[model samples]
Target chain A: MIDLRELYQEVILDHNRQPRNFRVPEHPQRQAEGYNPLCGDKITVYVHVDQGQIRDVSFKGAGCAISQASASLMTEAVLGKSLAEARSLFEGFHHLLTDEGSGPSTGGDLGKLEVFSGVREYPMRVKCATLAWHTLKSALEDESATVSTESPNPTPSGGP
Target chain B: MVKTEATLVAPSLDPGLLRPDFPALDQKIHGHPLVYLDNAATTQKPTAVLRALDRYYRRDCSNVHRGVHTLSQRSTASYESARGIVQRFLGSSSDREIVFVRGATEGINLVARSFLGPRLEPGDEVLVTAMEHHANIVPWQLVCKAAGARLRVLPMDDRGELRLEELGKVLTERTRLLAAVHVSNALGTVNPVEELVAAARQRGVPVLLDGAQAVPHKAVNVEALGCDFYVFSGHKAFGPTGIGVLWGRREHLETMEPYQGGGDMIVTVGFEGSTFREPPARFEAGTPNIAGAIGLGAALEYLEELGLPQIEAYEAELLSYATQRIGSLPGIRLIGTARRKAGVLSFVVEGVHPHDVGTILDQRGVAVRVGHHCAQPVMAHFGVPATVRASFAFYNTRFEVDALEQGLREVKEIFGP
Candidate 1:
């Protein structure tokens, strides 16, 4: 059984307390809203791309500690990365949270994102941890539709 | 003004003795003894209910109303007997008044489509309380939308009590029917159904009471309440799922059309059309959950044997104990503080989202419901995205409340200031 301490780490708690880039960027080029109807978690991800590089990334939402902290950490991780790199990071983070076999050590270049490996133990909370990344993916793809986690077939525009 | 100790009022039935009746309550989750507090969602079944289901499937398993064999006769007898139990449970005059549907949702839908749907005119309105479960609200919205009628809401106060003073203003000539929840699932406010029914009757408007949250914790007599229809889910009352009671007045059920077309609902078949059966049979349009009904009957019998009045008294003290204990905690804000409530306690911890509180609680084997509770409007009214709800059952004890309190403190500790 996964301990509560593992899931609610000091780092995750700190990010939740003072979420970094916790606002919509000025004149955001790409933005999308994500919602998890299960828990009523809502998140909007804003991204500004400059010359194939993410100039800024930010989010604003109301959710549990996992979702808010994940969003905060995501902004910090993908701030300066290229679009492809950011998508890859989302993939790696998703793998870390979903694949039980994929531990923190196995998550390549995940850095602080690996702290969420504990979330995999609580299957219900995986969606909470991944809501931000899914929203970020939608924002990156410039999807106009609001992403919902309950969507049956989630494509590039699909939510967590 | 919080009382640290249990109230002076003694519980008629001791929960300690009754706890053994429910086998599910005797287990552990995550190494800690299970503290199941999510009773409003669904209750754990007692041994009696379980035995009824087992006995039905094991020995007297057969289809009802059409079977001529001994097994079929037995099954049919049991099924109809369950209806009689429900009729008596609701204090309805006849078994024909009790129509067994899937659950409270289906019961409301049946009324919306069959009874209220056809009577609604272009400008007619259906008045519902603001604190109703979505099961009550959405069906009316659907029926109203299709019939070009309007759906009006009777608002509630900050305490989650309905604004009874505005009832006269809200009930206009255009109001075709008044539907309300007897007890709120999210907020534990017990609406004054008697007064609401009297007011509606004065205007010659019919009333439907959603008793899903009301039936489990208290005694509900549909006739006494004077509502046109009283609907409730069986599962919430320690019965089986997929079985519920929709008790309507004889006059209304006699005239209302059948909600569905299938076997066991028809008296005769013809090429073009068929003649339908009377009241209860007209509404139950399928094979009908035979075993589920028997199980539900046994569950209701169990409650009756335990005595609803005693159960109510016991639960009242339990709720008071819980309120005083949880309410006194620092940073804990009780969402629903209605003067009169039953089984539910909704709250939000300071600077902590409800989901986090729920997760931490679950880890400590204190099961709670956290979210909009299918009542997003209630959450909206309270200016919250969601709330952590710790509902009670008669079998629940103060020991479990202590576990919940301890778990909540751990949540505050983890998410430190």
Candidate 2:
């Protein structure tokens, strides 16, 4: 057993079990179905944008513990933030996952999301943890409407 | 009659027994027994195969077929003996019928390039099944594109089985080649190649079967199947990698040009022109994979001793048990449940991603393949996308099936039932 104290620390599993703003709003404006085709992970990210701010946010889908938990936590983090600020948060989180130099001021410390830092050691699971964040970005910026919760594009076998 | 402890007497392979055969299986992953269900991806080599590899390198290391020394002659004799064994294994009438290539991937490419590629004229059609591994499909696509021949795909039914009815409609006089899988890697659908071949022969169309997945699981007699060409990988059948067999009829071999040209294939190298050797030797260009061929030959000998029929029966029982157990699990959906199938169980848990399923199972020390399985078209056919595939070999047991079920239960617990 990968020590739960290390891998699925309470904060992470708590978010997974009872995600924040998990239900679709009674009246939502735009929705996109983001899919990660690799592992058949799907998340329907609903965005309620008003004026300049991403006022209300929610997600509904089936995914891994990391994916569901990260998505649940993402909605809580980005609520009431401006569209520009949400994109900035995405940059910070992306850096943490990719382990690029420009990680957050918290460094490798992912806060309540710290449990997922162990996932960096596992390059494959990094996607499971980041699947939601990718979809949220698509839902906010792209008008394509339906985003795929499918696994992020790995290097295609035959490079196009 | 079912075998019980007392009836079984010796009890055959034991918990501690089979464990020693696979070195990697002994190691703990997340504190559990490593149940290898990813045999379809590649099999873990047994002690016999490992030793064959070591013995080859340690004792009889020499370039084959051209050595004048005793060691060279021994190596050449053993190498040809290996080819002879492969020839017998496939029930080919002559040893010259077998051609050694890198692996199944290279074998398919060889046939596509040399045999089919040369003869295919403009407007001729090459028919391939939708359930084919990308190996079988992509190479032919390359041939068709270059030869100005059109590619026509034979669609699969909802169960992921080949649409045999639709096949009759497609096999026209224009159909110069008919290529299909003996067994589908992704779907586990065992295609009826004999019937397909019989129909294709009537139209004067040559048939090539992608028998990579089928060859390892059950008994195969190329003579019985009567296909023009049959290809399989040594690695998948518990042998060394970098080795595969491409068996063709003598007439076909004579007509087909060499796939590659370099050292061993040519008899003479004039400044202006070159003359090639005959048949199998002509096709086997460059310094051939001596060790791989030997290892594959040894692997066939092992299988012959084990009896393919016994392996098939044992695997079928395991497959049925796992299928039923997996079927009973709540929220579990088996992807390809064809009536005529091999021992592959592909599924998706409703609330859990396959990576999560894989990760959790990895924690439980159960290994399964999670991907499109290089059959994206089949994935598209199902419409649900990627699936977690638990492919079994003869070595697996019912206890492992129980463990898989337990792993799924844990998955249901993690994601919540």
Candidate 3:
């Protein structure tokens, strides 16, 4: 049996309780909306990119603990990083949550975002942990478009 | 409280005795005994239903109503007998009225496409309740859209009760048909469908009662309800998935065009055109789910043996007990508190998302539905994105409800301030 504590870690709970950057960034250059029609989870990601570097990142949404916390951690992790670096981080984060063989220690340089490593145990929640990341990725790629977890043709970057 | 004839003279139903009949119910998940409370989604099939499926597949495996072979004859008999069972179960006048479809969704689609779609005009309108499941709403929307007709909604109150007063205003001359959920799946509100059907009749409009959620909980007599059409899924009523019944008035069924065209639904095929079969066979285009229909017959027989009146009374008592037990908990707000409800209890925990609650409860082996329940409009009406719904069945017990309460307490503790 999987331990509940593994999935709902203390850091994840703390982030869910007091989500940082849980707001729309002022004068955002790129914005995108993400929705999981299955669970009614919605998240909007905003990024202000200046000279290929993420000047600011923030989000606002209503979702489960994993989704809200993931978004909160994402905003903090991606800030001040270049667009490519943020994309790499998203890739690593996605790998940690979905790849069954990969664990927190094996996932290279996930930093505090490693808290979502336990999400691999709950297959249903991987989408929850990835909703904001997908939205952020869409915001970076396209100017603005609504991204659903249930998108028929997922982006070439892959989707949950 | 809305009292039905079945609930008035009720016998006791012992869940303890009935529980063992369902093999799926007697199991453990994550070290705790599985407490399945997601009956509104689908029910666990009983041993009788399982045996019926096994027997049919093992002995009489043949296509229905096609060949002159002995096995085909036997399969056809069983399949048609299943329709007779459904006809008797719904108290419809003739077995000809029961047309088998994929499920309630397909059943509604048939009515929308075949019956109402051809008759609709540019200004015609179709009325649906706000609490309807997407199956009941989307089909009408499609038909109305194709015909350039308006789809009107009969609003429900915050308590999840239908505003019957609005029926007169919504049931205008332009209204071609009224499709409403006999019971709201999300809210558990047992709508006054009798009144709504009567009002639609007075307006000279046809009515289709979506009994997907209603048939599982209580006794439903379509003739008594006086509706033009009634539809329900077999899976939700402890039968097999992929099979359901569309019980329409013979007059309506005879006049409507076939929803699909295939071998079994035809009388004779020519190079120019093909004449269709009558009523149920005409609507059931392809080879139907013969085994599913047979299993559904066994399920209905099982329900009949137990008596729906007894099950209804037993479930009502259980619901009240659950309502009191779960409602008394702190920080738990019940989303749907309609005076007349079935076995559904939709609630939200303070400071905790329904998904989190569902996860926590699942850890403790309490299975529930945690989402919009395919009723987004109902959720929107309640101003909630999603809700944790614990729905009951005849085989569920107070012990299971207690387990739910304990699981919820754990959720509160883990997410508590």
Winner on DockQ between 1 and 3 is 1
lDDT of 1 by residue, B47-163 (tens): 999999999999999899986899999999999999999988889899989999999999999999999999998999999999988898999999999999999999999999999
- Of candidate 1 chain A, the 10-residue stretch with the lowest lDDT total is A151-160
Q: Candidate 2 lDDT, tens digit per residue, A79-135?
A: 898998787777667666667444344443345544565565556677777778877
lDDT of 2 by residue, B203-303 (tens): 88999988888888778899999999999999889888889999999999888888998889998999999998888998898878888888888888877
Better of 2 and 3 by DockQ: 3
Please give the lDDT score at residue B60 for candidate 1: 97
lDDT tens digits by residue: candidate 3, B1-417: 434566668768899999989999988899999999999999999999999999899999999988999999999999999999999999999999999998999999999999999999999999999898999989999989999999999998889998988887888999999999988889899989999988999989999999998898888999999999999999999999999999999999999999998879999999999999999899988889999999999999999999988888888888988999999999999998999999799999998999999988998999999999999998898888999999999999999999999999998888875
| Count of clashing pairs, candidate 2 | 12
Which candidate's lDDT is highest?
A: 3
Chain B structural similarity (TM-score) per candidate = 0.97, 0.95, 0.98
Task: List the DockQ of the predictions in order.
Answer: 0.55, 0.35, 0.54
Best by TM-score: 3
Q: Name the 10 consecutive residues with the lowest summed lDDT in model 3 chain B.
A: B1-10
What candidate 1 gets wrong by more than 4 Å, as runs, is: A152-160, B1-11
* lDDT score for candidate 2 against the true structure: 0.80
Arrange candidates by TM-score, highest first: which order? 3, 1, 2
Candidate 2 off by > 4 Å = A4-105, A108-115, A131-160, B1-19
In model 3, residue pairs whose N, Cα or C atoms come closer than 3 Å (at least 3 residues apart or on different chains), thus clashing, are none
